[model samples]
Target: MAQVQVQEDPDREERITMEAIVDAYGSEEQAMGWYYYLDDKITFPFQAKCIQARKVSPLKLGEVVEVTAMAPADDCEREMFVLIRWVDRELAVPLVQLEGIDVDDETEEAIADWHYWMARGYELG
Candidate 1:
Protein backbone atom coordinates (compact mmCIF):
# COMPACT_ATOMS: atom_id res chain seq x y z
CA MET A 1 0.00 0.00 0.00
CA ALA A 2 2.95 2.31 -0.63
CA GLN A 3 0.98 4.29 -3.16
CA VAL A 4 -1.90 4.92 -0.79
CA GLN A 5 -3.13 8.50 -0.70
CA VAL A 6 -4.09 9.39 2.81
CA GLN A 7 -7.40 11.06 3.44
CA GLU A 8 -8.82 10.67 6.89
CA ASP A 9 -12.16 8.91 7.26
CA PRO A 10 -12.73 6.85 10.39
CA ASP A 11 -15.93 5.47 8.92
CA ARG A 12 -14.18 4.21 5.82
CA GLU A 13 -11.37 2.70 7.85
CA GLU A 14 -13.83 1.00 10.11
CA ARG A 15 -16.02 -0.37 7.37
CA ILE A 16 -13.26 -1.66 5.10
CA THR A 17 -11.05 -3.57 7.45
CA MET A 18 -9.65 -7.05 8.08
CA GLU A 19 -12.59 -7.98 10.28
CA ALA A 20 -15.04 -7.67 7.44
CA ILE A 21 -12.69 -10.08 5.73
CA VAL A 22 -13.81 -13.13 7.65
CA ASP A 23 -11.45 -16.12 7.98
CA ALA A 24 -9.58 -17.88 5.17
CA TYR A 25 -6.41 -16.62 3.58
CA GLY A 26 -4.87 -15.48 0.29
CA SER A 27 -6.16 -13.23 -2.48
CA GLU A 28 -9.17 -15.36 -3.34
CA GLU A 29 -10.44 -15.14 0.21
CA GLN A 30 -9.87 -11.43 0.19
CA ALA A 31 -11.87 -11.12 -3.00
CA MET A 32 -14.71 -13.09 -1.54
CA GLY A 33 -14.65 -10.89 1.53
CA TRP A 34 -15.12 -7.78 -0.53
CA TYR A 35 -17.70 -9.46 -2.75
CA TYR A 36 -19.92 -10.24 0.20
CA TYR A 37 -19.10 -7.00 1.93
CA LEU A 38 -20.44 -5.11 -1.04
CA ASP A 39 -23.30 -7.52 -1.70
CA ASP A 40 -24.57 -7.21 1.85
CA LYS A 41 -24.23 -3.45 1.97
CA ILE A 42 -25.36 -2.12 -1.36
CA THR A 43 -29.10 -1.89 -2.03
CA PHE A 44 -30.28 -2.88 -5.49
CA PRO A 45 -31.61 -0.55 -8.18
CA PHE A 46 -29.54 2.35 -6.97
CA GLN A 47 -28.65 5.11 -9.38
CA ALA A 48 -25.03 5.87 -10.14
CA LYS A 49 -23.04 8.04 -12.47
CA CYS A 50 -19.90 7.05 -14.25
CA ILE A 51 -17.20 9.13 -12.70
CA GLN A 52 -14.38 7.76 -14.75
CA ALA A 53 -13.93 6.02 -18.05
CA ARG A 54 -12.03 2.79 -18.66
CA LYS A 55 -10.85 1.24 -21.88
CA VAL A 56 -12.43 -2.11 -21.10
CA SER A 57 -15.77 -0.53 -20.17
CA PRO A 58 -18.28 1.08 -22.47
CA LEU A 59 -19.53 3.52 -19.83
CA LYS A 60 -18.91 7.13 -20.69
CA LEU A 61 -18.02 9.77 -18.16
CA GLY A 62 -21.11 11.42 -16.66
CA GLU A 63 -23.39 8.71 -17.94
CA VAL A 64 -26.04 7.75 -15.42
CA VAL A 65 -27.12 4.15 -14.94
CA GLU A 66 -29.15 2.04 -12.60
CA VAL A 67 -27.00 -0.42 -10.68
CA THR A 68 -29.00 -3.59 -10.22
CA ALA A 69 -26.64 -6.09 -8.63
CA MET A 70 -23.12 -7.29 -8.08
CA ALA A 71 -21.49 -9.14 -10.92
CA PRO A 72 -20.78 -12.86 -10.54
CA ALA A 73 -18.33 -13.54 -7.76
CA ASP A 74 -15.87 -15.17 -10.15
CA ASP A 75 -15.93 -12.18 -12.43
CA CYS A 76 -14.92 -9.98 -9.49
CA GLU A 77 -11.96 -12.06 -8.43
CA ARG A 78 -9.56 -9.33 -9.43
CA GLU A 79 -11.49 -6.07 -9.27
CA MET A 80 -15.04 -5.41 -8.12
CA PHE A 81 -17.81 -5.07 -10.68
CA VAL A 82 -21.50 -4.14 -10.57
CA LEU A 83 -24.28 -4.92 -13.01
CA ILE A 84 -25.75 -1.77 -14.54
CA ARG A 85 -28.56 -1.17 -16.99
CA TRP A 86 -27.46 -0.07 -20.41
CA VAL A 87 -29.17 0.25 -23.72
CA ASP A 88 -31.53 -2.72 -23.69
CA ARG A 89 -28.96 -4.77 -21.77
CA GLU A 90 -27.12 -5.12 -18.51
CA LEU A 91 -23.36 -4.70 -18.37
CA ALA A 92 -20.86 -5.39 -15.66
CA VAL A 93 -18.59 -2.47 -14.97
CA PRO A 94 -15.91 -1.73 -12.44
CA LEU A 95 -17.31 -0.54 -9.12
CA VAL A 96 -14.63 2.09 -8.88
CA GLN A 97 -15.87 3.64 -12.08
CA LEU A 98 -19.20 4.72 -10.66
CA GLU A 99 -20.35 7.13 -7.98
CA GLY A 100 -23.61 6.45 -6.24
CA ILE A 101 -26.42 8.99 -6.42
CA ASP A 102 -29.72 8.89 -4.57
CA VAL A 103 -28.36 5.91 -2.62
CA ASP A 104 -28.54 4.95 1.00
CA ASP A 105 -25.68 5.67 3.37
CA GLU A 106 -24.57 2.04 3.51
CA THR A 107 -24.36 1.81 -0.25
CA GLU A 108 -22.47 5.09 -0.50
CA GLU A 109 -20.04 4.09 2.18
CA ALA A 110 -19.49 0.66 0.62
CA ILE A 111 -18.59 2.17 -2.74
CA ALA A 112 -16.30 4.61 -1.04
CA ASP A 113 -14.62 1.74 0.74
CA TRP A 114 -13.91 0.05 -2.58
CA HIS A 115 -12.58 3.32 -3.92
CA TYR A 116 -10.41 3.64 -0.86
CA TRP A 117 -8.92 0.21 -1.54
CA MET A 118 -8.37 1.00 -5.19
CA ALA A 119 -6.74 4.31 -4.37
CA ARG A 120 -4.30 2.38 -2.22
CA GLY A 121 -3.32 0.15 -5.14
CA TYR A 122 -5.02 -2.93 -3.68
CA GLU A 123 -6.27 -5.75 -5.88
CA LEU A 124 -7.44 -9.26 -4.99
CA GLY A 125 -5.94 -11.00 -8.00
Candidate 2:
Protein backbone atom coordinates (compact mmCIF):
# COMPACT_ATOMS: atom_id res chain seq x y z
CA MET A 1 0.00 0.00 0.00
CA ALA A 2 1.34 3.39 -1.03
CA GLN A 3 0.04 6.87 -1.49
CA VAL A 4 -2.20 7.16 -4.54
CA GLN A 5 -2.32 10.12 -6.88
CA VAL A 6 -5.97 10.43 -7.75
CA GLN A 7 -7.27 12.61 -10.56
CA GLU A 8 -10.51 14.28 -9.69
CA ASP A 9 -13.24 15.27 -12.12
CA PRO A 10 -16.02 16.87 -10.12
CA ASP A 11 -18.34 17.84 -12.95
CA ARG A 12 -20.49 15.80 -15.28
CA GLU A 13 -19.16 17.72 -18.22
CA GLU A 14 -15.63 16.86 -17.20
CA ARG A 15 -16.47 13.23 -16.63
CA ILE A 16 -18.24 12.85 -19.95
CA THR A 17 -15.30 14.44 -21.66
CA MET A 18 -12.79 12.15 -20.00
CA GLU A 19 -10.66 10.05 -22.25
CA ALA A 20 -12.77 7.07 -21.33
CA ILE A 21 -16.04 8.70 -22.28
CA VAL A 22 -15.20 11.38 -24.81
CA ASP A 23 -17.08 9.58 -27.56
CA ALA A 24 -19.87 8.46 -25.26
CA TYR A 25 -23.14 10.35 -25.12
CA GLY A 26 -25.64 7.96 -23.55
CA SER A 27 -25.72 5.84 -20.45
CA GLU A 28 -24.98 2.60 -22.27
CA GLU A 29 -22.11 4.12 -24.17
CA GLN A 30 -20.66 5.68 -21.05
CA ALA A 31 -20.90 2.36 -19.27
CA MET A 32 -19.05 0.64 -22.07
CA GLY A 33 -16.48 3.39 -22.17
CA TRP A 34 -15.78 3.07 -18.46
CA TYR A 35 -15.77 -0.70 -18.78
CA TYR A 36 -13.04 -0.74 -21.40
CA TYR A 37 -11.04 1.94 -19.66
CA LEU A 38 -10.96 0.00 -16.42
CA ASP A 39 -10.34 -3.27 -18.25
CA ASP A 40 -7.31 -1.71 -19.83
CA LYS A 41 -6.07 0.07 -16.73
CA ILE A 42 -6.43 -2.55 -14.04
CA THR A 43 -4.08 -5.51 -13.72
CA PHE A 44 -5.55 -8.90 -13.00
CA PRO A 45 -5.17 -11.13 -9.95
CA PHE A 46 -4.69 -8.25 -7.57
CA GLN A 47 -5.89 -8.40 -4.01
CA ALA A 48 -8.74 -6.07 -3.10
CA LYS A 49 -10.52 -5.29 0.13
CA CYS A 50 -14.14 -4.41 0.41
CA ILE A 51 -14.36 -0.77 1.34
CA GLN A 52 -18.13 -0.51 1.51
CA ALA A 53 -21.02 -2.87 2.19
CA ARG A 54 -23.84 -3.37 -0.27
CA LYS A 55 -27.09 -5.31 0.19
CA VAL A 56 -26.88 -6.69 -3.35
CA SER A 57 -23.25 -7.72 -2.98
CA PRO A 58 -21.99 -10.52 -0.77
CA LEU A 59 -18.86 -8.74 0.33
CA LYS A 60 -18.66 -7.03 3.70
CA LEU A 61 -16.42 -4.34 5.08
CA GLY A 62 -12.80 -5.47 5.40
CA GLU A 63 -13.38 -8.63 3.41
CA VAL A 64 -10.53 -9.44 1.08
CA VAL A 65 -10.86 -10.99 -2.37
CA GLU A 66 -8.61 -11.74 -5.29
CA VAL A 67 -9.80 -9.75 -8.28
CA THR A 68 -9.26 -11.55 -11.58
CA ALA A 69 -10.87 -9.69 -14.47
CA MET A 70 -13.63 -7.36 -15.61
CA ALA A 71 -17.13 -8.79 -15.74
CA PRO A 72 -18.85 -8.99 -19.12
CA ALA A 73 -19.65 -5.76 -20.93
CA ASP A 74 -23.38 -6.44 -20.92
CA ASP A 75 -23.28 -7.03 -17.18
CA CYS A 76 -21.52 -3.70 -16.74
CA GLU A 77 -24.09 -1.65 -18.60
CA ARG A 78 -24.69 -0.03 -15.24
CA GLU A 79 -21.68 0.04 -12.97
CA MET A 80 -18.26 -1.52 -13.24
CA PHE A 81 -17.75 -4.96 -11.77
CA VAL A 82 -14.77 -7.27 -11.43
CA LEU A 83 -14.57 -11.03 -11.14
CA ILE A 84 -13.40 -12.02 -7.70
CA ARG A 85 -12.58 -15.43 -6.27
CA TRP A 86 -15.00 -15.99 -3.48
CA VAL A 87 -15.70 -19.05 -1.37
CA ASP A 88 -16.27 -22.04 -3.66
CA ARG A 89 -16.94 -19.81 -6.67
CA GLU A 90 -16.34 -16.55 -8.46
CA LEU A 91 -18.52 -13.51 -8.07
CA ALA A 92 -18.93 -10.17 -9.75
CA VAL A 93 -18.63 -7.29 -7.29
CA PRO A 94 -18.91 -3.60 -7.89
CA LEU A 95 -15.55 -2.07 -8.64
CA VAL A 96 -16.48 0.95 -6.54
CA GLN A 97 -16.97 -1.31 -3.56
CA LEU A 98 -13.42 -2.63 -3.42
CA GLU A 99 -10.02 -1.06 -3.01
CA GLY A 100 -6.83 -2.57 -4.29
CA ILE A 101 -4.35 -3.61 -1.62
CA ASP A 102 -0.62 -4.05 -2.08
CA VAL A 103 -0.98 -3.84 -5.86
CA ASP A 104 1.33 -2.23 -8.37
CA ASP A 105 1.10 1.50 -8.99
CA GLU A 106 -0.74 1.10 -12.27
CA THR A 107 -3.50 -0.97 -10.69
CA GLU A 108 -3.62 1.32 -7.70
CA GLU A 109 -3.92 4.41 -9.83
CA ALA A 110 -6.66 2.89 -11.94
CA ILE A 111 -8.77 2.03 -8.93
CA ALA A 112 -8.12 5.42 -7.44
CA ASP A 113 -9.31 7.06 -10.61
CA TRP A 114 -12.61 5.20 -10.42
CA HIS A 115 -12.98 5.99 -6.76
CA TYR A 116 -12.34 9.62 -7.37
CA TRP A 117 -14.95 9.60 -10.09
CA MET A 118 -17.49 8.15 -7.69
CA ALA A 119 -16.52 10.52 -4.91
CA ARG A 120 -17.41 13.31 -7.26
CA GLY A 121 -20.97 11.92 -7.50
CA TYR A 122 -20.79 10.53 -10.99
CA GLU A 123 -23.03 7.59 -11.86
CA LEU A 124 -23.66 5.43 -14.91
CA GLY A 125 -26.56 3.29 -15.97
Candidate 3:
Protein backbone atom coordinates (compact mmCIF):
# COMPACT_ATOMS: atom_id res chain seq x y z
CA MET A 1 0.00 0.00 0.00
CA ALA A 2 1.11 3.56 -0.69
CA GLN A 3 2.01 5.48 2.43
CA VAL A 4 1.41 9.21 2.93
CA GLN A 5 4.43 11.01 4.26
CA VAL A 6 4.20 14.23 6.27
CA GLN A 7 6.85 16.89 6.10
CA GLU A 8 7.64 20.43 7.36
CA ASP A 9 7.44 23.75 5.51
CA PRO A 10 10.63 25.64 4.46
CA ASP A 11 9.73 29.13 3.22
CA ARG A 12 10.43 30.69 6.57
CA GLU A 13 13.47 30.55 8.85
CA GLU A 14 11.69 29.17 11.91
CA ARG A 15 10.42 25.59 11.89
CA ILE A 16 6.65 25.54 11.23
CA THR A 17 4.65 22.36 11.53
CA MET A 18 1.20 21.88 9.99
CA GLU A 19 -0.93 18.78 10.31
CA ALA A 20 -2.86 18.79 7.03
CA ILE A 21 -6.34 17.31 7.14
CA VAL A 22 -9.74 17.73 5.54
CA ASP A 23 -12.45 18.88 7.92
CA ALA A 24 -15.22 16.86 6.27
CA TYR A 25 -13.29 13.60 6.14
CA GLY A 26 -13.67 12.41 9.74
CA SER A 27 -15.09 13.31 13.15
CA GLU A 28 -13.27 15.45 15.71
CA GLU A 29 -11.04 13.81 18.39
CA GLN A 30 -10.31 11.01 15.93
CA ALA A 31 -6.53 11.81 16.14
CA MET A 32 -6.72 12.02 12.35
CA GLY A 33 -9.62 14.40 12.08
CA TRP A 34 -8.94 17.48 9.96
CA TYR A 35 -11.17 19.66 12.06
CA TYR A 36 -9.46 18.65 15.27
CA TYR A 37 -6.40 20.66 14.35
CA LEU A 38 -8.27 23.37 12.45
CA ASP A 39 -11.45 23.84 14.44
CA ASP A 40 -10.88 26.70 16.91
CA LYS A 41 -7.30 25.56 17.48
CA ILE A 42 -6.23 28.65 15.55
CA THR A 43 -8.25 31.67 14.63
CA PHE A 44 -9.46 32.24 11.10
CA PRO A 45 -8.37 35.17 8.86
CA PHE A 46 -4.93 33.95 9.76
CA GLN A 47 -1.97 33.33 7.51
CA ALA A 48 -1.85 30.41 5.09
CA LYS A 49 -0.32 27.37 6.78
CA CYS A 50 0.45 24.90 3.99
CA ILE A 51 0.98 24.95 0.29
CA GLN A 52 0.44 22.12 -2.19
CA ALA A 53 3.67 20.90 -3.67
CA ARG A 54 5.47 17.78 -4.90
CA LYS A 55 8.60 16.10 -3.51
CA VAL A 56 9.43 18.91 -1.09
CA SER A 57 11.38 18.87 2.16
CA PRO A 58 9.30 17.97 5.21
CA LEU A 59 10.47 21.09 7.01
CA LYS A 60 9.30 23.74 4.59
CA LEU A 61 8.09 27.08 6.00
CA GLY A 62 4.61 28.49 5.49
CA GLU A 63 2.35 30.93 7.36
CA VAL A 64 -0.96 30.10 9.02
CA VAL A 65 -3.65 31.47 6.67
CA GLU A 66 -7.42 31.43 6.74
CA VAL A 67 -9.55 31.55 3.60
CA THR A 68 -13.22 31.34 2.73
CA ALA A 69 -14.23 28.00 1.22
CA MET A 70 -16.66 26.97 -1.48
CA ALA A 71 -17.97 23.51 -2.33
CA PRO A 72 -16.24 21.76 -5.19
CA ALA A 73 -17.51 19.16 -7.61
CA ASP A 74 -16.78 15.47 -7.03
CA ASP A 75 -14.47 15.11 -10.04
CA CYS A 76 -12.91 18.52 -9.54
CA GLU A 77 -9.44 18.69 -8.08
CA ARG A 78 -9.81 21.34 -5.34
CA GLU A 79 -12.04 21.03 -2.30
CA MET A 80 -12.16 24.73 -1.35
CA PHE A 81 -11.42 28.21 -2.61
CA VAL A 82 -9.39 30.80 -0.76
CA LEU A 83 -11.47 33.96 -0.90
CA ILE A 84 -9.48 36.08 1.52
CA ARG A 85 -6.49 35.17 3.65
CA TRP A 86 -3.61 36.85 5.43
CA VAL A 87 0.11 36.11 5.61
CA ASP A 88 2.44 36.67 8.51
CA ARG A 89 4.25 39.49 6.81
CA GLU A 90 1.77 40.38 4.12
CA LEU A 91 -1.64 41.53 5.23
CA ALA A 92 -4.73 40.65 3.20
CA VAL A 93 -2.74 39.60 0.19
CA PRO A 94 -5.35 38.71 -2.31
CA LEU A 95 -5.12 35.16 -3.67
CA VAL A 96 -7.37 35.09 -6.67
CA GLN A 97 -8.43 31.83 -8.28
CA LEU A 98 -7.00 29.92 -5.34
CA GLU A 99 -8.32 26.41 -4.79
CA GLY A 100 -7.41 23.90 -2.10
CA ILE A 101 -6.27 20.43 -3.11
CA ASP A 102 -4.31 17.52 -1.75
CA VAL A 103 -0.63 18.30 -1.54
CA ASP A 104 1.69 15.95 -3.47
CA ASP A 105 4.45 15.83 -6.04
CA GLU A 106 2.04 16.17 -8.92
CA THR A 107 0.49 19.28 -7.39
CA GLU A 108 3.91 20.80 -6.89
CA GLU A 109 4.92 19.87 -10.43
CA ALA A 110 1.81 21.42 -11.87
CA ILE A 111 2.42 24.61 -9.89
CA ALA A 112 6.01 24.71 -11.06
CA ASP A 113 4.94 24.15 -14.65
CA TRP A 114 2.49 26.99 -14.46
CA HIS A 115 5.12 29.24 -12.96
CA TYR A 116 7.58 28.20 -15.64
CA TRP A 117 5.10 28.90 -18.39
CA MET A 118 4.18 32.26 -16.91
CA ALA A 119 7.74 33.44 -16.74
CA ARG A 120 9.08 35.63 -19.57
CA GLY A 121 10.81 33.83 -22.53
CA TYR A 122 9.75 30.37 -21.30
CA GLU A 123 7.67 28.54 -23.85
CA LEU A 124 7.10 25.07 -25.31
CA GLY A 125 8.69 24.48 -28.66
The model with the greatest TM-score is 1
For residue 11, model 3's alpha carbon misses the true position, in angstroms, by 24
The TM-scores, one per candidate, come to 0.90, 0.84, 0.24
Candidate 3, run of 10 with poorest lDDT? 71-80
Candidate 3 similarity to native, TM-score: 0.24
Off by over 4 Å in 1: 8-11
Model 3 regions more than 4 Å off: 6-33, 53-125
For candidate 3, the C-alpha RMSD (Å) to the true structure equals: 14.9
Query: What Cα-based lDDT does every candidate model obtain?
Result: 0.87, 0.82, 0.29
Q: Between the candidate structures 2 and 3, which one is better when assessed by TM-score?
A: 2
Q: What is the lDDT of residue 7 in candidate 2?
A: 49
Q: What is the total number of backbone clashes in candidate 3?
A: 17
lDDT assessment of candidate 3: 0.29
User: Candidates sorted by lDDT, descending order?
Assistant: 1, 2, 3
Lowest lDDT sum, 10 consecutive residues, model 1, at 15-24
lDDT winner between 1 and 3, please give it: 1
Q: Specify the highest-lDDT model's number.
A: 1
Per-residue accuracy of model 2 over 1-125 as CA lDDT, tens digit each: 22444545456336436767878889888888888888887889999999999887999999999999999898888778899999999899899899998988877877877777676566784
* Residue 28 accuracy (lDDT) in model 2: 89
- lDDT per residue, candidate 1, 7-80, as tens digits? 66677666577545667378899899999999998999899999999997999999999999999998998889
